[model samples]
Target: MSNSNLNSSSNHFSCPKGGAGYVCPDEPQFVGCCSQDPCRNVDANSTSPCPGSNLYYASYDPFIHEEIPANACIDGGKWFTCTGANPSFIGCCASDPCKSPDHTGCPDDDLLPAAWSKSRPGQFALFQDEGTADDDELSGGAIAGIVVGAVAALVTIGALVWFFVRRRGNKAAAMSGHRHTSSVIEGEHRRMYPCPASPSFISSWIGAI
Candidate 1:
């Protein structure tokens, strides 16, 4: 496909660079009009590129795995739609396994489109949200997260309470120190005080004077 030059090899022609305007499929495993990059003429007898989504499989392998069931799911299979049918059971997703289904799962031998229906689609439950709340209305992971958040909140509140209590103690100590520091100056003394000298000592001191 990388080579642009193409020529005839035998009954079939090798078109590495397909014909003009022949756009190759995005995936190398996908089917295209021609095997090469740009799809070229299907037959040497003809002069124009193959049209109508008809792919000449030179390198493309429709089936990648043997485990995949259903022919329609193969790579080269056309873009078909049952339209109100189980495309998955019939090999729709098999063609492009990259695009998985989120619907119910299907048994290997299920009756495909014939048994596919809206009321009872298939069995394959594809890409289901395991995180969704279940019968208990709460997922296990969600419950764990809630518990962790609550614990963190409780720790934060406990720390705040301890900090406020310590701050209040410090403020009370400062207030007590201020109360003890208040003093009476000589001229501003309002509180009266009694002298501690004895009455007999005062009478003897008067005889000495």
Candidate 2:
């Protein structure tokens, strides 16, 4: 009852020869498979008791082949098997949203491997690493947008700084020209009106005039 090559698409599967196979009619023995009559003899060449039936290939010996109930997956997930070293447990595939730190293994963009659990009496859980196929593309686009926005901000700041600096330079040049013009006008006024040689000479000249 080695489930290494278990088919996830079809519900029914075949059991190998000399293996603990053939699920009985009783529900307690195997709940996933269909039951056959006790009087009918099982064919040695045939692998399944009821061929082409949509049922789990659970063997009569519960220990050998684990029995997974029909309602095991509450969220309508299909049963599958892991390909790696963790094939002993039955894996459930579904399109449900998966939470972090526990869920892993994305089969498709929508389908995700919910969890790997044993179909036996007790459940054992195992999870694989998450795939980042589409995430990479999204991250790249985000990074590019950030880079473009930063460049635009830098260009705007540079333009503002240049305008302010040019305006300050123009104002300083105008103030310098005004001071030079006032100095020239004061020089001409001093030349036009010369000072008297002495105070006494200035008094005599005023009286004569």
Candidate 3:
């Protein structure tokens, strides 16, 4: 069917420049209201900007071969708890496909958009056959980073140890050189001032007698 026919059939309306303020965790394909229940609308006809949380892009789960609930955990489609005045309700993220002007995937077989948990947020789960490729890539990158950091730390420690050892060796060598110079000076003094215990002493004794 044409895009205009889909919009008219669904009774579609535009949300402001950015679209819905809150995401529909149950059916991320549709725009959601800020109330505890995504189905409840504060003012359906109002043209004012949606007053609620920030909008996020839709996260496609290739494993499921479908779009999982917005902001829901990929491991188990677990809904995150919403904070603020409505703490009892769950929060959602990701873009609403139904909000698109082109009426992309928003049209359903009934020619109606998502209405409050129609997508069944609880049903989404990762397929076991393929596993989570994205998560695995992230894990590999994290491991590489840790290894690089460890190597860098070891190199820095080695450099510091070598510097200290070289400085200590030079200091010891200088001290040894000073000691050797003092010893040589003492030996020269002994040679220049010979002891009076030879012919000089004997001549002096004979003269006195």
lDDT of 3 at 106: 22
Enumerate residue pairs that collide in model 2: none
The runs of at least 3 residues in candidate 3 whose Cα sits more than 4 Å from the true structure, single-residue gaps closed, are 1-141, 198-209
lDDT of 1 by residue, 80-146 (tens): 2222222222222224322336433232222111111122121111101122212334545567899
Give the whole-model CA lDDT for all candidates, comma-separated: 0.33, 0.36, 0.36
Error of 3 at 115 (Å): 14
Q: What RMSD does each model have against the real structure? A: 16.2, 17.5, 14.1
Which 10-residue window in model 3 sums to the lowest lDDT? 1-10
Per-residue alpha-carbon lDDT of candidate 2 for residues 1-209, written as tens digits (9 for 90 to 100): 21222222222232211122222222212212223321132356544333332222221112223223322332246554322211122323353222312333323332212212334322220011121113233334456899999999999999999999999999999999999999999999899988759989889999999
lDDT tens per residue, model 3, 18-120: 2232333332323322223332333456322222332222222122323234332321223432222111122232333334355342222212122224334
Model 1, global lDDT: 0.33
Between 1 and 3, whose lDDT is larger?
3
Tell me model 2's lDDT, rounded to 2 decimals: 0.36
> Can you give the lDDT of residue 85 in candidate 3?
14
Residue-pair clashes per prediction, in order, are: 11, 0, 0
Compare the candidates by TM-score and give the number of the best one. Answer: 3
